[model samples]
Target: MTVTEISRLALYGYQIPLNPPLPVGRQRITSRHGLLLRAITDQGEAVVELAPLSGTDMDGEPIDGFSRESLQQLQDELTTLQPQLGSTAALERAAGQTALPSLAWGLGLLALKLEGQLTSRQPRLAPVPLIYRLPNETADELVQRLATLPRDCRFAKLKIAQNDVEAELRLIYALLAARPDVRLRLDANGGFSLTQAVDFCACLPKGSIDFIEDPCRESADCEALHSALGLGYALDAPLNAPDFELSPLPGLRALVLKPMLIGSPAKVQALIAAAQQLGVRCIISSALESSLGISDLAAFAAQETPDEAPGLDTLAAFEADLLVSSGKALCLELGQLPLLASWEAGC
Candidate 1:
């Protein structure tokens, strides 16, 4: 069998406007910018997107937060390294030396797609948390939104650190009462200390929450809370930590894997296998990429964690997208997307 190789590389840049401007930390992002990579092989062509968070505004000032690198950084690196990336193995080697996780993730997907690994799979629905938007949204409004959720929606996520614990509790109770069949997933994003996390978890209705993600800054605090209250916890920010390890930590219910933040596909797959061996669930999530990126994520989720519903309820934020229409069930075609730059071995 002839070994397939990347015969050509085509790069395109896109700017998808976000209505209402996405709020990240203290910065507000008006538009999302990134690169689309199309890798052609003897078999066919595969496309992937590398849109980092905190993309620059019209003033060229980075929004600051979420992602470490900017879209310009990825473009520069890929342009300089385009010649050497002729195969999946070469891309992996290049990614191992790079500091950009988003680039590696995009290359990984492209490699997987070219190798016919990312086969299309049925898309699953993820509950959009009512609390992510509208900081001052009332419990009644939240409950009304909860009632609007699809009948088959089995899980919902909520942001707890944004609001006071008491007010959040009332909203949670309201959501539970309104849709008793749907379970709740709470994420603190490591905004709380040990004491505050404990106090907050103490007030939660027992057996109602699916898990609390990054409840505390310290892993020891998470373990302590789990031991004290037996509330399940999920690891999110810790996955990005330099010392991250997949252990069956006390109260570790799941691992929230964001491909954009995580390294390459191989590295992510290794983590998934190791995590599964420890009997922990892995939930593939998104960092608010356009429909193109989300389509790849859905394919990845179906290929890797078929049973778990991914946290991909983020496409609703984009004002518009390129090629594919906006939504979860989307598949990107290389011919459909516009191109900006191209390179080939013989060209």
Candidate 2:
């Protein structure tokens, strides 16, 4: 196995200003925050790794829970791994053995970048289909918002909190009435109890809805609801669970993966393999990460599963372009590395 010596490590915090504060759950985000990692090797090679922050357990927390305060902790952890690097295995050999998820992720990505460089089989970029995002608004308002969607749009996803189930159902019907050709994705974010979830499912026509996600907090509750209703439902946040194993719910639709929070590129690949074996769709979704992380995701998807349209249409939300775009694909733009290294992965 080829081993790389890590001679230096640097971490930087970057924030992109947001025009209007973006809201998730009950909190508002005024800016996007992420960590840019620079790994310099003893071989005089420098690889910039991007780890975007995302998915706050609390509404007000930073993305990925990799906050400003956690910087010191990350520094401390990555410091310990310096010894491992001096005698470390190349990413392919030690991928499954990685202990720290985030560090392993950053390093694995760097390694992938390097491997593509060495082998001359740099990753390729493909146009990813985007789900037109819909707001959790009134029926009339939603129809009005969806009308502005581009003509080629055939897929869409809506954020529904289940506060007013009847009204939300009506909105779904109204959306289909307006654009019946479009398939739908509904995210409830664990809003209902098992009974409530089942009742809500009962209100919908069996063949109308595409997938309803996280209807309740418990896996058993979601499984029971899917079994009872005979409708496809998705497990979104649970995909980040440690040592995540498939739950095999009866009406399982798709597995949503957030690569930043999911941590390791190898682990993400493993999950995709598992999903493929089970005949399940692995949808690579963004947790509102920066284009750096998004580029990471796009590169991974380009190689692993390029056919699926990842839930990653969030470039417009950013104030500036962190990555260069070709056709419809996003890729890294590393100045320190070659102009080629940026496009190498997306080549």
Candidate 3:
């Protein structure tokens, strides 16, 4: 067997526009921008891009946290490890450090392994389901977009917060009113108080919501919120804790996993196993990563029976996604999001 090693890492910037602004509470994002990491193999022809999740700032300002400085530092560190490790397994072991470079290197090695097992000349990849952030003014516009989507698209997501509970409720009502058959999920980003979250859940029209995600900040309170509303809840931020333990919340129906935040595929698989044992739902979502990251996520999602819809529809979050939307579905050819032509590194 020929042993290949990582040779170089290149970072690129991308910006992609959204059809409508993505709003979470008062924040509205018009475009998506982030950093891309490309890893060159010793084979010289094989390359894999590693994109981590870095979304727009509080004011919906686009900022690339995966900067050139950070990427170069990560690359240099990984290059130094290549001689000692000499194999992907050793690199995977080093990934436990929780450092950015280690995480990037781990992801790069994983991607390289995936590239080696090419099942097809052109791999058939699924489009990530996007959850549009609807502004108060054009909330109806989002509904219209959802209503127009093809019947095959069984999932859509909405962002909500405690500040404007009534407006969000009204938006949800309008969406359900427009598309009675579509499945709907909500993400509050832990924006609501326990009391307020309960009230909001109570106000929701019965069966209108599929599930509510992280209505409150804490996992304990998340369980409480679920009990109070007598509805299913999903955990997001709580699972990102480095030393987090799974306590098995009764009403908790799902767990949203962002690999960038979790930092390891092993951890993700562990969470999935725990969630499965506890009868909790599992969804693999994105943190506004580029196609490189999205490709990894899509592969993960495909491998699971996601209980709640995964938050993989982040293509619109970037100014350029390597994939394209074919009606309601995303088109991926050879791990590239074709819609984002501007951000194509190797494809």
In terms of lDDT, which candidate is stronger, 1 or 3?
1
Q: Which window of 10 residues has the lowest lDDT sum in candidate 3?
A: 338-347
Better of 2 and 3 by lDDT: 2
When sorted by lDDT, best at the front, the candidate numbers are 1, 2, 3
Off by over 4 Å in 3: 1-4, 7-35, 42-86, 101-137, 305-309, 323-347
Predictions ranked by TM-score, top down?
Answer: 1, 2, 3
lDDT per residue as tens, model 1, 181-286 = 8888998877789999888899988688899988887867999999889999998867865357787787899999988887788778988999999999999988
Q: Which residue pairs in model 1 clash with each other?
A: none
lDDT per residue, candidate 3, 199-251, as tens digits? 88888875867688887755578778766668888877777666778876768
lDDT of 2 by residue, 1-347 (tens): 35565555555555566544554533556676555655565556544344434434335564432222243454565555444443234444344464545555676776766444323222342323333233454558758666667666656777676347787778778877877776777777677789888887798765657788777868668778877878888877777666568855578878877766566677888888888888888777775666666666676766676667677766665675554453333333444222211111101
Candidate 3 has an lDDT of: 0.59
Name the TM-score of candidate 2: 0.77
RMSD (CA, angstroms), candidate 2: 6.2
Which is the better candidate, 2 or 3, if ranked by TM-score?
A: 2
**Model 2 global lDDT (CA atoms, 0 to 1):** 0.61
